[model samples]
Target: MMTIVVSVLFARSTRSTFPSDGSTSSLITHYLAGAAIASGVIVTPPAVLALTTYVLAPSLRHLFERLLLYPLFGAAALVFLFLAVTTWKPGPGTPTSNMDTAASLVNAAAASALATSGIIVTTTGILASNFWLTLYFDARRCHPYDHIVLFLLGTAAHIRRERHRWHDDNQVTIWRASLEVVAVQVERDAPLSGRTGLAEGSAYMELRQEARRIAAVIRSHKRDLAEAYSAHDVDAVVASLVVGLRAFCVGDRTALLAHAPAEVAPRVGRFARTALRLIPATVLIVAGILLPLVPSIAHSELASNLRWYLIVMGTITFITTREDLATKIGEAVAKVLLK
Candidate 1:
């Protein structure tokens, strides 16, 4: 459940960075590759054990008498083999493009096989007689579902990108420009500080101060920023202010001055919507945590199951929440608190 939550968070955070059209297919292919590799690893130990035992049965009868020692040796051999195959990278100029179809396919297949074998040997043990079946079943319970969720997340991102191509492009441009400004400032100021530490000395303090100033500037210019975004007329001043906000978000600092409108309306409506969903989940989590503290329900099976159910439901709610709106709310809160 934690893994799923983290993955969903990561997918949403980075989705905007992926190329609009190709992101989904690229992500799906990667997940498929991972699944294939996992499957291969799951099956390799049994295959190795069967091969070695059957092929050398008569000769290895004496060794097989010491069951634990023999299996350990077999496992060691599988480990060595798995390592060799998986780490055998081809030459730099290897033809991996579509034009070299056969070579690509063969290379991909070999890599997948080696990865799968390596994983199986590493996790489930190389000996066929180990708890291979138990491990495989356990893996099946959660692994595939995680990959499927990742795939679906990628697909959703792709659909969103396509649907809002122009808007996304504009946002991307804004952020890119913001990043460029930040990079320039870092490059210019980093050397003056002389120290390279992220959390030390005058440079770091200066950066923090600058960040606070930038955050203040952004807060003051909220109305203008909103107008620019809505009207699609982002001027240099607004762009700079947005960059300042972005820089502040990423813990960067540089001083800049800007002017803008006076009064900004509350943008908490989105946060309210998100809170409507999150409130129940938060309550559920609180209830779950407090269940054990209650004398009457502490030892009850129903209480334990209810706690688990609430946690699961809360996690699901978190994953399904609208990431964009949540991110905006978070940014708004950050700005307010920083002020």
Candidate 2:
């Protein structure tokens, strides 16, 4: 029953053309359904690849740890072989009754082998590639996805102030650590969380409380915080100086900024900075949403391809920009849910 329901949902989801003639509520429903479907499609491969690696890692740890791309290449070879077998067709021929019967049995066996091999090889290749890339990035201690995390969890307020600070030496680390610290505070004070909107009340209050906490921490280690913030790169411990400090309140912001140079502060307001960060993602989203509406492109394979391309590009833009899109979403949601 559940499987049938899910299948129906996915089937309906794929047919969505984002019709422009719909009522407002209908349009919203369609958009949300389409977005949900897209998110599932986008996330499924990575989830499967991760699970495959985890299940195989214990037995094949050495192979992945050392061989890396060699395993991926071997997997690719298997995939090519599977494809070759599946596509190979019997040549034009005439045969007796005995030959026909024998050929049918042979073909059945071949079909079974192809089906089994295709699944195994495809999954192996996907997991091998994912694991190799993960190891490659891990060795360098730099994960680009961290930028996405920063954007998702960051408030528009913080992104507005620290937009320029992103990707700088120790900047990602600083923000990540700060978020962890704030998360700890939120968790500890879970009972005290506001009854109103999650962000407007809870997150806002937490940011203020965090500001005071950071101010105290800085007072005792002013020189240390200053030196780390001003340096090109900071170690793990110092890197977590909480970038949120500067955005929470004027006093804390001033104290934290005192150590850094005057030129480091952003010149624009929060809304302007947030808008700047959103441009690429917004453009891609707009293009994706509107491309299929063109009469010339309607129902064509090119339209489908371009829409997927735009969707992927837009998603990448959102990821690369550190989730400015999500911040906007949170802000919008908070407004509706405000007490």
Candidate 3:
């Protein structure tokens, strides 16, 4: 039941062209039903249930595209299940603490093996089912090759170690530590629990009161609190926030310059500087876009020569502009201030 639910959910969430046309949902439902029926039929069970399901599903009789897709979807579900199991971590109270690292390594290796096998099985099942030729050109509508490339990319990413940072801790430890430090003050101000059966409600009231007291204390020591937070830590936090805001405000000249609309001359100067720097690459890109319209010009020997010329000019422009921009920016800043 868990397997079926997870497979259905994954199939639904995946990006497929058929989903927009409402065929993917039907295909997945029928495929899983077929797999379940086949599982009951074979006394010993086949080596690949996905292959069996693809072969047995009568709904897939006329739908050659579904015949190819169902097996791939099944294989993907198996891979996702394997990954989930392998990466799952036990709670803090769970046993096997000493072997946790070793166990993780083993699980990762096994999951990689399973993923590779799943891909192989999917490919083999498609070929053995004799749907490859039918799917080759006809399946272009579904972009199967793009999906395969994406799957390979996902698998590659999964095999790599995940990157984590201290900032990713969600600040839980910091909150816990703060509570612990103020526990004595909290107890002095309010009872930890009420008498009789009113413990839950009383505890909630005490927590609210304690939070108010903590907030007041923080407000009173705002200056000291500011000083206590190191310059580096404050800068790091500010920098992180600025990075996100900067990305959002990118290309918004008014937000970036913070000057009045009357400053048209400086804006024009900036534009001229930028356009001069980008001329080589911009010309090449424009030529590439326009060349196809004129067959005579496109086929001329000059056209072939321009490709190498563009490359050389682009390289020189990049190097010179990179070096020139810093000097030009300084001069612009001086001119603005002196004005």
Compare the candidates by TM-score and give the number of the best one: 1
Give candidate 1 regions above 4 Å deviation: 1-112, 116-207, 215-339
lDDT of 3: 0.40
Return the candidate ranking by lDDT, descending. Answer: 2, 1, 3
Check candidate 2 and list the clashing pairs: 151-322
RMSD of 3: 27.8
Clashing residue pairs in candidate 3 (N, C-alpha, C atoms within 3 angstroms): none
Model 1 lDDT tens row, 232-334: 3434433454444443344343334233223323233333555677787788688767875698887765666666655655655565676676556545544
The better candidate by TM-score, 2 or 3, is 2
Per-model TM values vs. the true structure: 0.25, 0.23, 0.18
Candidate no. 3 TM-score: 0.18
Which one wins by lDDT: 2 or 3? Answer: 2
Whole-model Cα lDDT of every candidate shown, in order: 0.44, 0.45, 0.40
Evaluated at residue 110, the lDDT of candidate 3 is 38
- Candidate 2 residue spans exceeding 4 A from truth: 1-191, 194-289, 296-339
Candidate rank order under TM-score? 1, 2, 3
